[model samples]
Target: MSVCKVIVMGVSGCGKSLIGTRLAERLEVPFFDADDFHSQANVAKMASGVPLTDADRSGWLDDLAELVRVEQKGLVLACSALKRAYRDRLRAGNPSLQFVYLRGDMDTIWSRHSSREDHYFNGRTMLESQFRALQEPEPDEGAITVDVSELPDRIVERCLSALGAPDRTGES
Candidate 1:
């Protein structure tokens, strides 16, 4: 089987983690939430309602990039990846890497964010900063854009279809 490396990306509250986890299960690969890679300092900054600077994110991105570099069987990564440069860092040595952008309207996402609990990204201001920093993938970037309005299962199906991945949901 060919390895499939995918980055499920978007601003917070866009359901990247939810869909990416299900997508990885369907694809029979490991799923990693980028939130796990953040430093305590970064988390604290975010918890304090401060947007992370590039310096704050560089090390975390490097660590994730390295994880991508060494995963022999491929894995699904859920990351905000709001900046083109951040995506470029992840794309560095992984030519087969593909990105799934979870695009959604601010109002829709804000509503979802408001209803969610126990997440570090709770501030509306940070969400706005994320939008300000987002650079939607260009036509040549080979990203698959999926609307976040869809259900998680449907979103995963759309992503699998777009990537030509088989639905391996029942294998064991």
Candidate 2:
């Protein structure tokens, strides 16, 4: 089996972590949550409802990219790679990186965010900024885009299907 690095990316509250975990499990590889790599300063800033600048994110992206590069096999990581430049930074060292964009309507995202509890992001404030910052992946970028409105299992199925995994639907 060819190892393939997969990034589950989208705006906050778009279920990147949940889906990425399932996809990684299905693929039998390690799963990473990029949010876990954020510095204490960045976390505190976001907790206070501040949007991160590119400078704030550069180090984090570099860390994620380096993690991917060092892993001999592929893995799945969940990140809110809101900007093209950030995504590029992640792809800089790991040329084989592939993205799985979790696309959803803003209303759905906001609704999900609003209901969540004990998270750093201020749903009301951050949602707008995330949308503002997001640069949708280009059609030619070779990243698979998935509509996140579907069931979680179905989303994993779609991701694996896109990755050319043999049909493991019934078993899982």
Candidate 3:
């Protein structure tokens, strides 16, 4: 079977990890959360409520791009790819990379953020910065945009359908 390389992208509170994990399981592929690949300094910066500048993220973006290149078996990655440039960087060498943008307004995401207990992205300022930085994929980009207001399973199904991949979500 052919594998699907998917990137579930959005701002911090938009459920990229949750949806990406579910989508990977349904697609029968490995899953990767880009948060795990962040540098210690980047983690510390976020933990301290400091937003990362492009310089801080350049290396991280390169690392994620490398992951897409090296993980030839195909995998789903959850990342806050908030800039068009970052997405372009990820697609630099891997043209088959598919992006699933989890789109939601600040109010919608803020509610989800407030309920999460373990995430280090606790400051509203960070959220604002992310929103300010986000560049939703354009019409010609061939990226799928899903409403974050939907249930996680539904979002996964939507992505599968859009990608022309069978939904093996086992939902009966």
Report lDDT (CA) for all predictions.
0.92, 0.89, 0.90
lDDT of 3 by residue, 41-79 (tens): 989999999999999999999999999988888999999
lDDT of 3 at 37: 89
Model 3 regions more than 4 Å off: 167-169
Q: Which candidate is the best by TM-score?
A: 2
Q: Which stretches of candidate 2 lie over 4 Å from their true place?
A: none
TM-score of each: 0.96, 0.96, 0.95
Stretch of 10 with least lDDT, candidate 3? 163-172
Error of 1 at 8 (Å): 0.2
Pairs with backbone N, CA or C atoms under 3 Å apart (clashes), candidate 2: none
Superposition TM-score, candidate 3 onto the true structure: 0.95
